[model samples]
Target chain A: MTGAVMNPAWALLAPVVLGVLALAGAALNGVFVARAEGRPALSGAARPVLEVMRLMRQRRRVTVAADRLLWRIGGMALLVIALLKTAVIPLGPWILADISVGIVWFNAMDVMVWAGMWLIGWGANSAHALAGGYRFLAQAVSYELPLMFALVTPAVAAHSLRVSEVVDAQQDLWFVVWMPVAFLVFCGSVLAFSAWGPFATAAGADIAGGILTEVSGVDRLLIMAGRYALLATGAAFAVALFLGGGSGPLLPDWLWTIVKTLVLLAGFIAVSRRLSAIRPDRLAEVAWIVVLPLALLQTLVVSIIVAVRG
Target chain B: MLSIIVFSALAIIAVASGIAVFRVDSMARATYALAVSFVAVGVMLVMFDLDYIGVITILMMVMEMAIMAIYMIMFMGMNPALMPMSMVHNNRWSAILATGIFLLLAAGALLVPWPARSGTAAPDLTVAVGEALMGSKMLVMLTVSPILFATIVAALVLANPRGRYDRWGDNLKRVCPDDPQQGGLGK
Candidate 1:
């Protein structure tokens, strides 16, 4: 009876607890990032997007020109897709829906970010919103290449697209230690994907809050919440990919896992803040020509290293 | 029971937001709606027992949206969700393609023969995952780190119009307040 009872429960424990913890990790990471950059820290950095949601709930204003349906859809889609990707990630020993092509699936789901943003911008019908939408396409085009390359590097090195396999491959040596260059590139891409500073060309004050300018009330809140959750998730990937994910001394596997995730997130926020003064166009250019090539080179080096070691 | 409740709630939220992805009026609203949908999905995935994947889903999407929003603000110079614009330029074709793809994917999901467990499961899944990573796959990751650094440099070179000298003045001696000829931020 105990065996049967424990089995399912144990199976469930890994996914759910770690999932929540991972969410928590991103917030913690952002807080550290903010603090490192001499910005104000809050308990809510553990949940950086609460303010946006609060603001949203407080109002429900809509411009007359916006497409009613698409406007509502954009915010909603962003959050759901972000969450769906998390279902495949493995924390410590637990995973849900571990597909053979888990990596590809994860990437495919992420493309929704691009689609949703475009829809949002186009639907809003405002000139500025349209421009912001176009900027997203441009930035996505540039950063995605390097990001994909960086993501594939791990699969190539591991000889499997399964994230679990990729993680398994890292036991002897954290990929970050061995492939420092790839690590850096992956980190950069994560930042780009997250729209952290230096690369935050789209949504700053200069852009009048970017694509979200027209959004008021609860819709705005949902989007903001989605952003925080996304931030947390991205940071967790960094931990999983390069860092020896959840590998540490003494602490329970879950606690260590959270700690590692927070560290990566802090690093991202710090980088984002550091690049605050830089222009977005400059950032985009660097991501494409420079970062992409470096990522390719990193892949080559890893292939060579594996070839020689094998 | 708690797990069931949590997951059910998450699933409902995810599905609701997923619908909203296409239901909203403005671009910004759609973005937010989609974000909420993803968050709910991520949470639901956590309930599904894939912590790493679920967490990453949240992180990657957040950053992606942030960049998207940044672009929206910078270029549009207005709120993206407030205006009524036609996002579905080629609606009929897109619908057909989307439906076709969904059907094919669903078919695969249902029909494909999945691999059964071959070996005994590891007691500690995390450690097992760790072993697989370092045991063989470290090389691929090894190569990509420098690629990221190079990207940083390239972004700087391509994006910035001026160099260090432009900002600091010619001699690095003083700020030229009157210099309208600055190339980068200094100008």
Candidate 2:
């Protein structure tokens, strides 16, 4: 139902590609973070996978008050959301589940991150961990409105909520140039939802790694992997939504999609290095007062432009 | 046959989780149980090809429960390792009320005739909903948005115990509220 539909087998390959991309992005983020802390970049790059090995060998530690069932659920939920979110983006011309409501699907999948983060926090039953969970919920409330507004702007410009349709609409004029505010808000919210860099308040170092403090062993590895996957998938979605998907001259569309995603992912990693973690409470106020209004205005402006053009 | 299998599996899950919501002792488990129930309903909707609405249902319910979990943690938080605590209250009344509502709903489902399939399920239901909202019912749809804003304002007021007066103090000279945590504009 999309342009230049390809063999369905590519769907199988998409996950592998996404996994590698997410790992690479995580490595890049590690390097940036390492450099900022005056550490060796090589170790930083290898850290995510290395941590997985270390965590695998380590015995699982459970807090006595911790809800074991919910903890595992929380850890699994993150990876599930990441995978679900990836299913929406068109890797080439088609995706695993190219549903008509692909944009909404992306949003829906992302909403699962809320449960994932909170469950892990609440599961730990520790003060710091619980606080981390609470922080993420507050942040989610603050950023969700702006994020929804930003997401809707592209749908308005494209005249469709489908990701492929949005990409198709951007063939002429990219939404980023016109919907700049929405793009900015989208980036900010993406960082927030993924708990990356500046928006990493939920897992900040202050409360002893926040929700992550009590988690150890394979559980920690899974959560970290899920987080990297979330970050990478979000970057991919940004490419599809704002950077005009695979639309570019002198290259295959799929290649362009990959390149754009990598660039955006690298930018995210670098940007996170430059900014310190935002305080969740302060962020809540700013989100409602500044970002939400700005995002709404962007949507209004885009809707008007679309109306006028039509 | 396939539809029957899928719907049966989904219905069983939904009902099981619904029962688990009350049966689960810990607050977190209860919240997740409710989430699981809602997710099952969402999946059932997807089975009917209502992708947009189903997905939205799943998203909204998960986020809602996650928020609920946070609130539970904030107020009644203790060591999870220490003891498993029961969160259910007004159990007898709740059970009776739930049973009554369930019976009423079941009666309606059995007594009332469900409408026959209409127009081959429309190729794209999302577009139809959008057109219905933006095309004819735009005014009604636009009017309801303020309710959401009202809810947000109301929630913020209720959640924040410290009022503006409490924060500013009597003289109104303090640049920042002396929140125990500190770190705002002043910091």
Candidate 3:
């Protein structure tokens, strides 16, 4: 909407940096989770990296009668979805794509993650993995509509589906201040879709890693890393859409972006640890009965406010 | 030149993946293959500057594929990979039918007199779609609204074999409603 406020040079590195942080943040979340569970935590911050190294060195494992091609595709797609999602986020003033319909682009990428997770589960050819896959699709179905509705409030408030325009519209007040319900529903859906924290039923430990039961070595590493990246991208998007992208006074715009993303990510990780995994059947009821109505209400209020203001 | 290259590549991808759909052994692979083909079409749509429609295409297709997989699992019974059943059937007749339809579509595309451009297209096509839906074409939405609601009702009815009255009672006094399994929320 306006001339570039951030250096174009930073655009290229932003995704790479975001990805690395996602990996690290995921590993850090593991540490937090370990400490919370009263288990011996890994020695240092390098634990996640070290774990990746171990996975790379270890021989890859495949389940009996596994569909290797689909498995590989599933494992890889998560990271790709995360990267594509981050492309729409403006780290400062410029985004990677800067498309007019950036918000929809983000939505499109997330929907791909639905297919990705299911693929990972189905490809394994194990009952656990297949069941896990089934569980996630239910979770995906449950949250996706309400999530789409939640995504719409900011777009309605700004009267633009472009991510940067949504940010620009928050000059006086962040949408989250007024649209708290949408924000909360958004946070819950992010957890649901990413299959992390409370919504991690797909990989709930009871089923011996569920969809991940048959995954091993480099594939597991990629899937795990990709999840963190997904979470990180979600946090980055939340920053742009709700927290007012790069809007802080003291720091450089990009710095604000990074800080806000990290804070939200950490908050997600912390919140996830406190909550038990939500069963799919239960989640479906809550998603349809509760969150769906609230999100629609939030959208209605935002639209009414926008019309009145105009 | 770039547009041509991009379009050709995407067209190839879409066709190949479409063929892969029938060829794939498992339902999961077919679902993904269709999704991939739809995504390629979506990207092609964006390349043509129909960004809003393109993204919506990608969104709806992914959700559809995911839902299809679930229905397959529910009705078909057992693992898709292990099953390995061919979705293709009626070989000669189906192929002939497909070829005839393709020819008809291609002929229509090549011979039909297209309408001339009316005005400069809006750069923000999302807004354009919104205005058309809310303003001039509001009746289209109104017509669809009841159908959409009916679809939801139909879906719930189809998916739920036993109604709440069956689970609870005529008086609706059952506390847990005899759930097969426990939910995350007690209700």
Candidate 4:
């Protein structure tokens, strides 16, 4: 694979591309929901558009003594953070920032979600929202370390933190083939951070929507879109970091990137739909005791291989 | 010109939000205001071309503040944190101490005779930074990190109210450890 192409003009396209991908993911999720209900798949696929329109027309809800400033910031930050994450991700050869610490940059952006989700919970001055926020943090503490090690595996194997270099290093064999444990952990972390699948307890119905309990209209719209966007971005980054990015037959590099992202994203949505939500307190033990060690061992194995090759 | 403008703007933001941390009445606001200040400083670090340090600073600081906010709210007496309570305490000494330290730092920054750039920068500053900081001390760092981690684990274990004895019967014959909350793993 060739080196990344840097152009400021391409930066403007990042959000537009992410939005489309997010929309597609949402539609896939809608289709899954419809299928479960024994309804037509096509109508379920169109549900996101309808939901967007319905939400646009819905009135904004305000709770008593809400911290409007922090609440609005929290609501809006997710989509913005998702957009920021895409800056470091290269679509085939085209990239926006191409910073030296692309992997860390992505990590930093995801970390912002902790603040955003919490603020959404805290700003409402409601019990459920606050409980939801705390749940997210609890879940985050478990997934984050394993995720960090998973991220480090590729960077260590490539001997560089640069995302493009990671893609280039995979010309021989994809990191996913050797680092399956890390990839699985990374995918699980993505789901956890996005608050999808078993990690959706933060917004679980038990807490009356948790962080989403009080949001309405545009605020609700933004948070929902942001979740899907985050899922899409995570899938895209997984492609670049593990799957040989844009390395495929017939299709162009950029198309390959999109194809891989969508496929993985659909898999995520389907798997999340199939699984039940795991309580944060219960998840803590399994994540630390089981997942963390496996991820660490995977990294250790990758490190040994890299050292031996050298 | 653009770089200078951006730097100045970030400096102003850092200072302003640092002040906001003290001034804000709400605990969440105060915590996030401090976060904003650190993020601005982290951005400034990026401007200085320490991309790894800068980004890591942002990541670590934000995560810390998020957890801190929870502890602040949880521990604050009578739930004053939820209410619009005064963020400051022992105002007089704190103000004096803050002013004194700020002045001392400012004075040191201005008075210190800084060394001039003697050679061109390394091609990869991240690698250069790692080598400069860790080359000779790699063994020490590697050893120290595990010791620190073990210390933390030991501390938590000591401080924990519930231990194996508390969970299981003293005879250790129970099939399941009796607990108020069930863990994901059946054991």
| Best-performing candidate as measured by lDDT | 4
Choose 2 or 4, whichever is better by TM-score.
4
Clashes of each: 131, 4, 0, 0
Better of 1 and 3 by TM-score: 3
Writing each residue's lDDT as its tens digit, candidate 3 over A174-269 gives 889999998888888888778999899899888878889989898898898888888888888998899999898989888888899889988998
lDDT of 3 at A253: 85
Tell me the deviation in Å of residue B125 in model 2: 10
- Interface root-mean-square deviation, each candidate: 8.5, 2.1, 1.5, 0.7
lDDT-better candidate, 2 vs 4: 4
lDDT values, one for every candidate: 0.66, 0.83, 0.85, 0.93
Model 1: per-residue lDDT, tens digit, A1-310?
0011123345455435434544564566567767777877775484445654477568676675566666677767666665766765656665555566667666666666776666666556666766666666667767777777778888887887777778778888888887787777767666655555665555556777677767767776666556555666666666667776667789875566677876666666555655654454544556665777888989998889879888
Cα lDDT of model 4 by residue, B1-187, tens digit: 9999999999999999999988888888999999999999999999998889999999999999999998888787586588987788998998899899999999999999999999999999879999999999999999999999999999999999998887888987778888888887756
**Model 1's lDDT to the true fold?**
0.66
For candidate 2, list the clashing residue pairs, or say none.
Answer: A64-B81, A65-B80, A65-B81, A66-B81
Off by over 4 Å in 4: A1-5, B103-157, B168-174, B178-180
**Cα-based lDDT at residue B50, candidate 4:** 84
Ranking by DockQ: 4, 3, 2, 1
Residue B183 local lDDT, model 1: 24
**lDDT by residue for model 2 (A1-310), tens:** 2755567776677768878988898788778778878999998999878877899999988687678888888878787788778778886576666677888888887888888898888788788987888888888888888999999999998889888888888888888999999988888888888888887878888888888989999888888888878888888899989998888889988898899999988888788778877888888767887788889999999999889999
Model 3: per-residue Cα lDDT at residue A48: 82
- Compose the digit string of candidate 2's lDDT tens values, residues B21-102: 7787777787889999999999899988888889899989988887776566447647642256776778899889999999
Clashing pairs in 3: none
